[model samples]
Structure formats: structure tokens, C-alpha cells
Target chain A: MIINVRELLPFLIPLIIFQLLLMISALTMIVKQRRFKYLNRVAWIIIVVVFNIVGPVLYFVMERK
Target chain B: MNQISALFKKEAVESIRNFKLFLLLAVFIIIGIISPLTAYLMPDIMAMVMKDAGIKFELPVVTAVDSYVQFFGNMNQLGLPILVIVTGSILTNEFSRNTLINLLTKGLKRHNVMLVKFLYTILMWTVVYVFGAVTAYLYTIYYWENELENILAAFGLTWLYGIFLISVIMMASAIFRTSFLGVLFTVLGVVIIMIIASIYPMTAEYLPQYLLTSNMSLLTGETGMSDVMPAVLITAGASILIFLLSIVTFNKAVM
Candidate 1:
């Protein structure tokens, strides 16, 4: 499958940047906060990096105790 | 008056310090950007995917109305839930952290605490809604130059619905012991209102939920000011009434 990255760059760029910003912010908080409600730091790091859009948001809403 | 302002300022500063304000604004702004972007690019994306599968389909021409519909739909589905999740634990978490007791012991009136939280949360809602709406408006106009009818009223009605939701969630948070329970009760309240509105469609104009579902219709001129004014007024009234109930509940709460 030949996907044209150049063709979609205009539309995909903003979304990618936003996703990165959210992830970085979540990761910084996860690293700084030493509290855990359900999962530990390693588990949350995995979740945040693995889930992409939902991972960071889940951390922010549920795991940020 | 001084006490109220002091409390309000305290809440506002707390919200900022905790990054709730920044997080929510970012979420809403992203939603705002994605709505119109998706509406604009969906046809091409679909075409590309279909071509890969050896299928052919024609998509209808997208317009400003489509953009606004997408924006409102995203706000209703994801944005509202985010609002509930963020503020659903406002009072319950305070109770859990023992801050409520600390403030009360310091001679802060319970009602003032409740009122301050309510005012700040609603103020945040208003600002966030405006941010999303303005971004969507600018992108839609730039992409598709068309005039919409009753634009202000459409935005106003949606904002009112948001206020109504925050009121219900605040009351639920005050009544429930755990933040999770508070969120559950608020979701249940919304579901019940939806069921009742569906059963009595004729009275939808009197139901606060009507404003949320019919926002797009208002922009397209299918719904008029007369059709929306009733729901707007009802939502405003219900927000105030439920807010009062939340205050009473907070006062009687055993914190």
C-alpha cells in the first residue's frame, strides 16, 4: 500500500503536534507526581506511551491522583 | 461581598495552579481545530480509502453548516463528558482531601464555598465554550463562506445547556461521597432527562436537553427563536434551581 504522506501532511500536521503536546505534558506530570491510585509509574508510563490519544487523557482524568 | 470575591479568587487561582484551566482549554481548542478539519478532509480521505478497496462512492458537498454540525456534535459527545469528569469530583474530592473541613473551621461559610465553586466552574465553562466556538467559526468561514441564521442564539442555547449540566454535576458531587459516584449520578441524571424528552417530544421545548440536541437546527434556520427561547429559559431556571439545591445539600452535608 503506497500511502502518500505528502498529500495528507497539511491535515495531519496539526493533529500530530497537538498529540505530542498532550503526551509531553502528561509525561512531565507523571514523572513529577509520586502518588498512585491504581497503577505505578512504570504501568502509567506504559499506558501513556502505548494508548496515544486516549492514554494521556486517561492518565489526566483517572490516573492523576 | 468581600468574602465572595476572596473565595472566587481563591478558586480561580487554584484552578490555574493545578493546570485544570490549561488542560481544558487545550482539549477544547484541539476539538475545535479537529472538527472543521475533519469536515473539510473527510470526503478526500474516504475517497482515498475506497479507491484502495476498489469501491466508488460520492459524498455530498460539505458546507459551513456541516462544519458547525461537526463542531457541535464533537462538543456534545466528548466535550460535555470531559466537563463532567473534570468537575464531577469538585466537592467530593474536597471532602476526601479534608479541605472542606479546613475551610469550614477557618470560618468560611459552607454556602459561600459552594457558591464560589459553582461560579468558577461555570465561568470556566463559558470561557472554554467561547474558545471552541470562536475557533470553529473562523475555520468554517475561511473554508466555506456562508451566512448562518441565528448564530448568536445557537451559541447561547448550547452555552446554557452546558451551564445546566455543570449545575447537575455540582449537585451530584455534593450529594455523593465518592467522585466516581458523583460522575455516575450525573450521567444517570442526563440519561433520565434524555429518556423523558424522547417520550414527550411535544414538551421538548420545555426540557433543557432540547437546547443541546437542536443546536444545529437553529443554525440552519430550521428552528426559530420562538422554538428555542422556551428551552433556553427553562434551562436557565433549572440551572438556578438545581444550584440552590446543591447549596442546600452542601450545607447539610456531614463534612
Candidate 2:
């Protein structure tokens, strides 16, 4: 039942990097924007940071004005 | 021609500034990467869980086909909806914001607008789809040595289905004023087609939804090209017809 971390690092790294880049971009935009369409800044930041890949996507698609 | 290119440039610039392009590419590439990795890890993960329950079952050897199976599944379930939701507002945004009004007033042909949007959607879909497919292919090959059957037809049919979906979205956006409604309509339309296909299996050959559902069989060679040709032709024809209908409706539409 033991899984080796080294065995998974290569596969995990790229996935994590892609997600991090998306989250960071979404966070940067959320911080810079003065207003959003539906939610306030703090709510959006939580959504973007907490929801992994989908939250930031929702922000970019729906909230970012 | 010049107007089309000009409008295309505008679309490109707008998508870039708004991060649509970046988001699409990143999300799809993630899907691409995750698909192969999941296929590769499936057996080990299963073993880890089964070890606790004293269930010993022999798992089949995973191959490149398994990777593609995951790829197609993720693409259909995750990739397509994201594609629809992300680009759903392409035209509705213009309408709601009245951005198209200035262009129409400045002699931009209504048909040209529809055509450019259609082309832009196809271009973006193609780029991201190919990138995702290629990434999955590379990773799948790197993990498994087995070769896939009907690889080109499988991928190409899915790509065509995506184009068909894009046309449906464009038509929906033309009819609905809000991005949310357009996405809802397109998703409902797809579901309706799938429901019909399931209820009347005889009509499955003609439904575009068949393309998405039959891809796994096609990959495994259980579904032949002849079996898929009818749906392919119907989807291509329907895409063109629906696009034309969108333009006709868009022309008569009150801006």
C-alpha cells in the first residue's frame, strides 16, 4: 500500500505547475480588478484560490469584468 | 476578406486580453496531462485500495489505448463543457455590451461577423484540442508501448464533433442574449440529442452525439469507418446548415 513519492513526482509536478500558474494568474487579475460582476473581491479570491483549476476558470469566464 | 481579417484580429486581441486563450490552453493541457497519468496510475491505485479488503484480482495490462480512453472521456466530460462555457459568451458579450453596434454601423457585414466568429471558434478549438491530444499521445506512448488502432479517425471525429458543438454554441449565442442562457441552451441541446439517441437507437447513426459516444469503440476497432461515416456526414452538414441559420437569424436580429 505504500506509494513512492519519487515515483509520482514527475507526473505530479507538471500537473501542479499548470494548476499553480492558472491560480496565480487568476489571483493576480482578481487583486488588480476594482470590481467583479457577481462576487466581491475577498469572495472571489477565496473561490479562485480554493477551487483549484475550476474556480479561477469560473472567475475569468463569469466574474472578471 | 479584409473585414474578416480585421475582425479576427479584434477577436484575437480581445480573447488574449481577457485571458480566454490562456485559460483554454492551460485547462486543456492539464486535461491532456491528467488523462495519461490517471491511466498509468489506475492499477496501482486500485491495488492500494483492494489490499485492505483482501480482494485479489488480476488487472489487465494497461496500454496506450487506456490512455486514449481516458483522454476521450475527459475531453467529452470536462473539456467540452469548459470549451462551451469559456467561449459561450463570445457573441453574447458583444450583444450585451453593444460592441457589435459600432462595427455594424461602420459597414461590417453581419454575415462577416458570424463567419469570423465561426472561424475564430474553430481556430481556438483546433489549437487547444490538438495540443491536448498531442500531449496525451506523447505521454501515453512514453508510458505504454502498445500502438492504437484508428488513431487518426478517432481523434479527427472527436475534433469534428467539437466543431459541430461550436456551431451549436454560435447559433445559441445568436438566439440568446446572455452568456449563461447560451451555455445552458447548448448543454441542453446536447443532452436532448443524447437522450434521443439512447431512446431511439436506430437514429444513433445520424446524431452528432454518436460521434462522442462511439469514439472508444472506434479506437478499439469495434466500430468501423463505414459505421461512423453517416454521423460524420450528418454532423458536417448540420454544422454548415446551423451556421447559415445563425447568420440569417443574426442579420434579422434586432441589435
Candidate 3:
């Protein structure tokens, strides 16, 4: 079974775009914030950057004061 | 009326500023995209995994039903919890921050506050759910070129289940002082309903939990409209009743 990367690009692009958008927004919020609820700035940056979709969502849902 | 609109506007602005609106929309859109994408890619994924394992197998045909199943499953498992967690603190935040004190003193009716929050949350859920559902539907159609059965009823049932979740959150927030507890109880309430459905089976037709469980069957025409009508009616009624009860509880709640 040969899977063509080019053929899959259109299907994959939106997932990547939405994910990156989410990550960017979450990072922006983390950088702007002086205080966080559960963890420090660097930790959240790592989580938001590392976990793809769930990372930013966890930060937004859990870290907001 | 004026007070309700004012409260609604405040809710909107606050959610926007806090990134709650954006987070909810983004997560839901991703869920929407992932459902059909996963369904469409399942066979390829299976083949890739199987090839590495030195296993020979025939892949089951994936259809539009698989996409719908993924949509409902993801919505129920991932989407609802996120909705609850994100909006769970709607009332508790005001309570903890002491923001409602000034509004209450300024002659804002307690019921109006509850009503606006409920309406706003429902509106958000509806918009996000529709966006996710439509995306899945379009992608599924693009891949399969087949029409699904009972599309309206299937989607509408899931939407109503979402409304039921929002109402649960509303009631839980009204009853619990902390956002964590509010969210916990909302999830627990649904789990309990699920348990009841499983344990009794006889009552499954009338329980709100039936809404989420029956979607695949509804989509495949295995479940008829008349079969789900009771659950649908009960869910709609339960939502309204629970919301009104929440308003009552909110009225008596300490600010």
C-alpha cells in the first residue's frame, strides 16, 4: 500500500492550520500573563508547544485565573 | 428585557476577552475535522500498521456512517467535557471574583443573570456544534459521495444532547460553589444517567443518555424516528426543567 504524501496534503493542511492557530493563541496568552494558576510560564509554554491540540486546550481550560 | 440583553452582552464580551470563545470554537472545529478525516483515513492507517506487523488482512469498507459515528463519538467523549470545563466556571468565576455583587446591588435581577448565562452558553454550543457537524458532513460527503439516512434527526439529536449538557452545567454551577465541583457533577450526572441506561435498559428509551447512544443507529436507519421520540421529548423537557430549577437555586444562592 503506497500512501502519497502530496495526495494527503489537502486533507492534512486544515488540521495543521487549526492546531497551529490554537498553539499560537495559547502561547500568546501564556506570554502575556504575569501569573498562572497551576504551573509557571516555562512549563505552560512547554505543554502548549508539546501536546498539539490537547496542550493548548488544557492550558486555556485549566490555567485561566 | 433590557437587563437580559445587557447581561448577554457582558457575557459575550467577557468570553471573547478571556479566550473562552476562541478556545471552544477552535477545539470544536478540530473535532469536526478530525472525525471525518480519521474515518476517511482509517483503512490506510490500518494497512500501514498491518504491513509493519507482517499481518495480511482485508480492510473493512469505510462509509459515511463511520464518519458520523466518529463525529458523535468524539462530540460525546471530547466535545462535551471541554464544553463543560470551559463554561463550567461561568457562574463560579463571578462568585469567586465577587463581580456579581456590584451588578446585584445595581438592581440586576438574579433570574436575568442566570437566564442570560444559560442562553449565551446554549448559543455558543449551538454555533460550535453546527460548525463541527457541518464540517464533518461536508468532508464525509466529499470522500464517500453517499447520502446519510435521517441526517436531520441524527444531527438534531446530538445538538439536543449538547443543550442537555449545558443545562446540566448550569444546574451544577448553581448548586456548587467551586468550578471544579460544578464540572465534576455535570460529568458525574451524565455518567449516572449512562449507568441507569445500562442497568435498566428498559428506561433507556426515555433517558437523555439515549440521545448520544442512539445517533449511529439513527444515522443507519436501524433506529426509527418514532423509537427516539420519547427520549427526545424527555431530554428537551428535562433541559427546560433543569434550567428553571437552576434559576431557582441561583436565586437562593449566596453571592
Candidate 4:
């Protein structure tokens, strides 16, 4: 079965959105818990903010205390 | 022996209590089986849909490679994330929850904790992966038998990718106290490696991503086994190094 790359594009946007939502929620959790003690907070914050919504979410999850 | 056995026992028992791992397993199983099946059915399904318009062409049926390709694709793109999800917090949970701190104070060696959790998660990935591969293989064999040059090589690539993924998960889990962070780090690492690999095809064989796709060319005899040896070596080496480093990092990482 051959899958054209074109057909796959339709799925990626939503996957990205879901990822962003997941990131936002994760960051919210860390923020809510008030746990921030790391040497990489700026790098972490930039990753979250730059990657768009998911960037921060992913960073928050990574930065969790 | 005690650490290995007790860790396994604890992890097994914990697996029973936690639905998170089970849920991830279920999702993985679905992706593993369905992605190939969908790819296999695509031609026929598309033909059927287009049949009404008389837009017909010879429908190419699916093969074992197709299923394997599906397996690899799903495993790399989606399955890795699931492993990250399960492993991201396996060790950290206890620390974050104030559960492991008491246990560690009682007498657990930091290395023992890392090793146990690492082994357990490896075992978990192996079990689920074997189950998924076996199911897909049986179904593939049932439907098509041609062009299966090396069943082992194709599927082996998928598992090898898992080895790399689990290693990343272990390290990421250690680096981050939370699961999301662990997964993010692992994903970021993978993407970075992939980007670097794109620039250097020579390094392609060593990339974990290649462990999933390179075997297809090898099986079809399009590339020599030598094409994949470097990847196998790199993935194995990286996995071992990461596991060890994760232990060191975990030993120092505060819960």
C-alpha cells in the first residue's frame, strides 16, 4: 500500500493543536502548584512560548518540580 | 538480583494498579494494528468509493512490508510518544508524590531505583511491542506472503526504535520530575537527531529513526545489510549510554 505524502497533511494540524493544548494544560499545572526551581527557566519559557501553544505545554511538563 | 526482582515485582504490581500504562498500551495496540490495516485497505476502500465514477485502476493489495511499514510509521510517529507518556513519570511519580522519598530514606539505592525502573519499562515496552508485532505478523502472513525478504529485519527495526525511545524516556524522566517534560525532552531530542541525520546520510544508519525505516530497503535488497549495521550499533550504544547516564542523573535529581 502506497501512502502519498499529500494525504498525510490533513492530520498534522490537529495533532499539533492537541499537542499545544496538552502543553498549555501542563504548564498551567506547574504554575498552579507554584513549583519553579531550575537553572533553565528562561530556556524553558522560550521553548514553551516559541513552539506556540504546545511549546510552553511541553516545557511546563518538562520543567515540572 | 534483589533489586531486579523486587523492582520487577513492584512495577508489575504498580502496573496492575495504574490505568495510565494500560491505557497507553491499549492506544498503542490500536495504532499498531490499525495503521497497517488502514494502509492495506486504502486501495480497495478508495477504489470502492471511486467505483461509482468509473475511476478504476488496478488495486495493489497489501503485503507484509506494507504492514511493517505501517508498524514502523505508527511506532515512530505515535508509539514513541506513548512510551514517553508511560515512562516519563514511572520513577518521578514516587518522588513528586512524596512516595519514593520515604522508600529511599528507608534504604533504596539511587542506582537501584533507576535500574529497576529502567528494566521494568524496558520489559513493558518489549511485552507490548512483541504483542503488537506478533499480532501484525500473523495477520500479514494470513493475507500476503510474497516480498517478505526478512520478516525479522523489518520488525526488528521497529523494536530497535523502541530501545532508543525507552532510553530517551528514561533519561528524560530523570531530567524532568513530570511526565510531560520527560516526553517533551525525548521528542525534542528525537527531532534534533533526525534533523542532524538529514544533513548527513552517512549518519542515517546510526539514527534511531532509521532503525524503523532503513530495514525496508534492506529487506527489498535495495540496500545491503551493511546499510543498517551502523544504525543498529548507534541505537544500541546510545540506549546503553542513556540508561547509565539517566541513573547518574536520577541519583542527583531532586524529586
Q: Score the docking of each candidate (DockQ).
A: 0.38, 0.67, 0.72, 0.04
Error of 4 at B202 (Å): 3.2
Range of the 10 consecutive residues with the lowest summed lDDT in candidate 3 chain B: B177-186
Better of 1 and 3 by lDDT: 3
Q: After superposition, how far is residue B223 of candidate 3 from its true place, in Å?
A: 1.2
Each prediction's Cα lDDT score? Answer: 0.80, 0.87, 0.86, 0.67
Question: Compared with the real two-chain complex, what DockQ does model 2 have?
Answer: 0.67
Give residue B131's lDDT in candidate 4 (0 to 100).
72
Best-fitting candidate, measured by TM-score?
2
Considering lDDT, where higher is better, how would the candidates rank from best to worst? 2, 3, 1, 4
B177, model 3: CA deviation in Å?
2.9
Top lDDT hit: 2
Tens digit per residue, CA lDDT, model 4, B26-60: 54555555655666676767877877788867777
Superposition TM-score, candidate 3 onto the true structure: 0.95
| Regions more than 4 Å wrong, model 2 | none
Residue A46: error of model 4 in Å? 34
True lDDT of residue B26, candidate 1: 71
Model 2, residue B116: C-alpha shift (Å): 0.2
Native interface contacts kept by each candidate, as a fraction: 0.21, 0.59, 0.69, 0.00
Question: Which candidate wins on DockQ?
Answer: 3
